[model samples]
Target: MIKTIIFDFGNVFINLDINGALQHVRDTFKIDTLSDEMTAFNSLYEQGLISTDEFLEFYTENFPKLSKEELVDVWSFMLKDFPEHRLRFLKQLKSTSKYKLILLSNTNELHITWIKKHIPFYSDFKNCFDAFYLSHEINLVKPNPNIYKFVLNQNTLTANECLFIDDNADNIDTAKSLGIKTWRIDIESEDVTNLFNVKTNLF
Candidate 1:
């Protein structure tokens, strides 16, 4: 029996144009792909090992032609619309009080800042979860077994009793390896609002 539900914040909730964002950045920077150093910097930033000021400074120094605001805009372009029906579903689920709800996401500061500014019901969405863990805030990220261990340990939750839902295959694999049930949502044909119907076997 699944007593807890852990959800990914990106494609599972808010829409993300990951490929589109990467293409936009490549075109803006006139680079075919992100360099190793840039990738490392992003990982460090997501792990909260670096401050937001330091992150912005690195980008500003590398691309002197681009302002901090422009860089933020490009970085945050991956975040798309968050449907209200998802919030409604979450609210209804919370109201049931039948299971522990946790939100686990690998997100950075700029992306969250953009979300808070653009999403009118951010607080309502957040309140639906009993625990909310963001990578930068928690200094841990998905696909890392330690992060899952931390959540289980923190909540005294047995992995077998928790269902982890994410859009990332790697993340799902890690959770499954940890003995947690998982749903790798297909964003193209699946909507989170249909969770009960889609995951009927689990329920």
Candidate 2:
């Protein structure tokens, strides 16, 4: 019996063009590939180990030709629209009160700020979850066993009783290794609104 449902924010909720964003960054930087240092900086930023100002400063210093506003726009280009049907489904699920709803997302300040500004129903969507954990705020990231452990421990939730849905294969694999049921959603073809129909056995 699954008592709790954990959801990933990107792709599972808001659409993300991850590859597109990376291509944009590469073009802007005139680089063929992202360096190991750049990847490390991104991880540090996501973990909240660095401030937003510091993050911006690193980019501004490296790409002196780009203005602050341009940097922000490129950084946030990956995020896309949040479909209304998904929000409706989530709201309905919350109303049922049959399962504990939780949202776990690997997100940072600038991205979330863009979400709040673009998605008008951000609060309504947020309130549907019993608990919301953002990586930057929590200083815990996915594909990491410690973060999954933190969620289970903090909520007093047994891994077997929780079903996590994410678009990332590594994240799903990590959750499964911890004895948590998971769905690695196909963002290109599947809709989260079909959760009950798709995972009928779980229900």
Candidate 3:
């Protein structure tokens, strides 16, 4: 039986336009793709290896034309409106108290700060999760085996008894490799509110 439900914060919940954001950056910055150094800084920021000021400095130093505000807006372009229905569903689920709820997200301080400022119900959404693990705060990003291991170890959870839901195939694959049940959510057609119906076999 699945005793715990782990969720990804991006498309699985708040909705992220990853492709759109990338395209926007490429067009605006006149770059076809991110350089190795830029990619490295992004990854480092996500894992909290570097502070927010340092991350901002790296971008500003490289892109002198962009201001700090502009850069932040660009970085947050992927984030869109969070549906209240999802929160209602989560609240209902939490009320049940049947399964342990967890949120595992690969995100940085800047994105989180932006979320907190925009999403009014951010605190309520967080309260639904029994345990909240942010990649930046924990210094462990997803798709990495060690991060999954850390969650399992921290909660003393049995791999088979946990269900991890994410929109990323790589993340889902990694979780499955560790013997954890997973749902690779389709952000477009599927709604997380239909979790019980869609994943009926698991329930």
Candidate 4:
């Protein structure tokens, strides 16, 4: 019956250029790709295994040439802008009271802090969700079965009764494996502006 709608926050709400961040760092720092250590540390960073200060320190110490601000800039480059129309759509959906709306995002503390600072209506958008789960805060990131299981357990939602929407195909596949219905949306084609079409009874 789809009693709940679990949404991925990145492309679903705010625009994120995942490639942009990598490119930004590569070009600016003269680096070809992420280092093996950085790649390994990222998993821990995303899961909140390390504190924010520890993350910033790791980069700052390794790249002495790059200033703290510049490191933050490259790290934060994936974030672009949040459109106004999407916020309105969420507001409309919240008013409907048809389904339990939850946001599950694989994001870190620094990016989240940046979002709140940049987006004027950040609080309003968050208010629309029945639950807003962040990977760093929850110590669980998506594409892992445990994170999906955590949400299901926390909300007491059965897999069959929830629909998961994510821009990442891997994340969608993981959700589907757990018996949840999923929409692996293309960020370009899927305008969440027409969310009502995807959902029924959201009056």
Give the C-alpha lDDT of model 3.
0.94
- Taking the tens digit of each residue's C-alpha lDDT, what string does model 2 give over 1-203? 99999999999999999999999999999999988888888898999999999989988998899999999999999999999999999999999999999999999999999999999999999999999999999998998999999999999999999999999999999999999999889987888999988889876
- How well does candidate 4 score on lDDT at residue 13? 88
Candidate 1: Cα lDDT at 72: 94
Summing lDDT over every window of 10 consecutive residues in candidate 2, give the lowest-scoring window: 194-203
Q: Candidate 3 clashing pairs? A: none
User: Candidate 3, residues 113-191: lDDT per residue as tens digits?
Assistant: 9999999999999999999999999999989999999999999999999999999999999999999999988877898
Candidate 1 residue pairs in clash (backbone atoms < 3 Å): none
lDDT for residue 146 in candidate 2, whole number 0-100:
96
Candidate 1 local Cα displacement, residue 142, angstroms: 1.1
lDDT of 4: 0.89
Cα RMSD, model 3: 0.7
